[model samples]
Target: MSPTPEPGLPARVRVHEVGPRDGLQNEKALLPFDVKAEFIHRLAAAGLTTIEATSFVHPKWVPQLADAERLFPLLRDLDGVRLPVLVPNERGLDRALALGAREVAVFASVTESFARANLNRTVDESLAMFTPVIARALDAEVPVRGYLSMCFGDPWEGEVPVDRVVRVARRLIDLGCAELSLGDTIGVATPGQVTALLTALNGAGIPTERLAVHFHDTYGQALANTLTALRHGVTTVDASAGGLGGCPFAKSATGNLATEDLLWMLEGLGIETGVDLDRLTGTSLWLAAHLGRPSPSRTVSALSPKES
Candidate 1:
């Protein structure tokens, strides 16, 4: 039975599934191109419209996705789904464009520490690097999405200021990004902080429609924070299938908000995501078997067959 509909929540939510890229990027074992392609196909089969397929970063950086060039062709035939790949810079953007990618996303950091650690450049420097990338992608008619990490708290620099995040977010918007995904990279954000950040962004002229939230489950607040965002009129929520993915750059960060778990909450609240929980859970379980482990998602665990 579904819970009573809330007054302020959005009628529908778009779940941006990030398992293929963000989830597998940090894995110790390298999966074959076929497996990766199958994973994405299965995700699309489960009704995920906007699936982050892979990253175009150099193989030296994220070796797991080195097969990006070969993997993309397999997904070209997937209809009615938006497969957005992550491009770290102009080079990455070039690769993605060459592959006929329809959509792309660039990762940015709001804090200097993570900016240096992850991208080896300061916050402003990283944005400056993305300037040309965003311009070229936009010129080519490819929609660009900006991912701003470390929005709430930074491991090196704790407690990010709302104004600082707003400034960077505005710059990304000004740089021709169609949408901005604010990431709680360390997953330390709570309900109140989520409200504060969304309000701040609104005050700075960034509408809720153009924004998405990507929360990690480090402090076990991913769901609570997501609910806060939904109430604030944010319709796009980022989650990983089976609770896979964390920042390889930020070791302190944990798995992302699980898609099955998020689906459970949304279904219970009478919110529509159009995702088949049973199929998605099965996909996670299949992947978990390939990776030699059980899924970390609570929903998957609860719904999986129990042992005798």
Candidate 2:
């Protein structure tokens, strides 16, 4: 409800934890359905209200999440949290609906190359594909979230035009998306680029409150880019705990900005996110132990007493 914080201080950013979905999707060892369920439970126990639980795309694409049908039901949001599952098409929507999902998400890239590689379709094709899916979700009373990847830069497409971004974004919100998340997929965005994009979106009649932001830490620009977006009035932010996410298709790209780091910044800025920073650090630690890798979060790094 309040504005994002200024530089060198806290931010009003609301961090959405994506660890259960993004973090586990790329894992080499597939966790059992129960493990995934418990992971989501612990995330909620830590005071994170928004948790991106799983994707409903076909099993052939991401075999790790093939059990999403089983996973979603197990992690059902019976209370106190919003669990948004990723749905890319009618079939994904059907799967989400069958499992009693209250919210769903769809994605389209800001660049042609990324769109083609990520979804095997052109940008417009991807947007067109979601028409029926969005319609179905709305009909079923399921909230739909739109994810626009590579909002700032694409590895193969070079600099993305602001007009392209605005055009795609306008279409998403127009099509019934409850929220639009601008993603710097390969994390090539600078703070200035973030500001410019958000400014244009605001001028395009897309309220800052309706737009959310997702940033990768590839070049260590995620936090800075997040700051720029917040200052421009964006509130919802997508982050994975312990920095537990990355794009398999994008070369050299790193994880999403860590949830703990974002929470640290938000708490400092006096934003009331209703997230427990200490509990968040604990979840990050538990996850790092499960994954056997160093967490990529600065706040978790400072909080975790475990030897490096």
Candidate 3:
């Protein structure tokens, strides 16, 4: 067996906050549009430059974010913030464009099962679906993000092939996506898997600078996987405040890597993220109170007083 090759880590990382879109999507109790808007504002004020605001999917698909149009307008005046919304298709893109979204994201799955379950299409079909969406966004001078879910493991297929992930990722980049976010949807990835995946992607000519990692903490490896990504030169990571949301299609998928938890590790390593840990923790606490549940973030739990 060969030891994993360590790449030089970046001096700073960009944490993409996905709480408003991805996090709230899986919640049963749909928050009001004002609540969601306030949440995004709080996240931005806490120094999250890249916050995924809302998804332009049909209301039938994700009722929690059905107020996307209304919600986006409320945060239009937020300064120095990049609010990217998820667009599932051309119609979704149309909705986002109507809302004057400057950035948007499209999602696909690396595995066939997840692709079908999540997108109701095959892998190739899903990519083809996003082709026009990506093109139109780029034509409109809007930056588009590509989300490749089930990169490491799939709920039905178990461990996914690294080659498949790389192939899908390359296609995404070729389709005009400005950046790609690799997701550990079920959180079954270990550090070794993370390194191997990134190495394979790098070998396929996908630079780390154009990639982001999205990890779920189901198997308690989100932080470790993130560390491995950092060491492999990936500077962008996807996290949710309060560790909210899971995959509705993937039954085993759990909460995403918490922003507070990721921030703690980065700050401890003296890595800059321009995010305030205390303020982030408070934001999580406020969100937890709204959700009427304790945060799943270990850092938030550890930092809060008994009374809190």
Candidate 4:
């Protein structure tokens, strides 16, 4: 079934598949290194070009990804895929660099509470911590991606002002980040808020091309918010397979926008994502079986065979 095109939207969208890292980080079942590596390989086989392979955060912080060292080596043979790892600080960056990571991302929060809660530092202090990390990564010829969480609303601090988000976003851009991913960490953003924030960022001299949207489905607005972002010229989107992970720090947050769910909409809209929906769905189902549970994705549920 060919999709009818929508005017004024991007012809192609880059799906930043975060299932391996963001999706699995919060899972209670600790998968082995081989299973994790195979999951990534299957995702790439499904045509996801850029996959966030894993995080280099301390084992004490995120024990699920404690095997970053062992897991990354197995993926060194994967060709034509961008496996960007998450680095929490200088030590995380060093671990990624030691393993020949071509790209890395640093996470940040726009609110003081989340910054202190997640990074154990004030907003300014966290940025200061990332300053050298971003610089060092750039010096090593590795592009840095900055993730700005709580762009719309926060559980600790409600109603994040657009101007405040813009200020922090600019600081990240100035810090030499190649791209910035605006995260709706708690999934409280509406279409109107999405428009306002993107407009404010554009007005503040941040090009739409340099920005990406990461929405959570807590309010069931992740897809709508994502579409609004696409209308506003944001081509890069972050989604997790099977709608799997949430912010471990923010209890109110739900799973991220599912890759299968997002792919359905993009395919229906005639927007090119280059992802094989069937293969991706199969991968999600496979992972779900391993976790001894069913997937949370609506699209996956609808497409999956019914039980007798």
Best by lDDT: 4
Clashing pairs in 2: 10-269
Worst 10 residues of 2 by lDDT: 1-10
Residue 288, model 1: Cα distance from true site in angstroms? 0.2
Give the lDDT ranking, best first: 4, 1, 3, 2
Arranged by TM-score, best first: 4, 1, 3, 2
Please give me the total number of clashing residue pairs in predicted model 2: 1
Q: How many clashes (backbone N, Cα, C below 3 Å) per candidate?
A: 0, 1, 0, 0
Clashes of 4: 0
Residue-by-residue lDDT tens digits, candidate 3, 1-308: 12233446677899999999999999988888998888888898899999999999999988998999889999988988999999999999999999899999999999999988889999999999999999999999999999999998887888999999999999999998889999999999999999998898889988888999999999899999999889888999999998999987888989999999998888777788999888888888988888888999999999887863
TM accuracy, model 2: 0.93
- Candidate 4 regions with alpha-carbon error over 4 angstroms: none
Flag the better candidate by lDDT, 3 or 4. 4
Angstrom error of the Cα, residue 45, model 1: value is: 0.8
Instruction: Mark the 10 consecutive residues where model 4 has the least summed lDDT.
Output: 1-10
In model 4, what is the error at residue 245, expressed in angstroms?
0.5
lDDT of 2 by residue, 131-223 (tens): 999998999988889999888888887889999999999999999998998988888999988988888998999988898899998888888
| Of candidates 4 and 1, the better by lDDT | 4
Give one digit per residue, the lDDT tens place, for model 4 in 201-268. Answer: 99999999999999999989999999999999999999999999998989898999999999999999
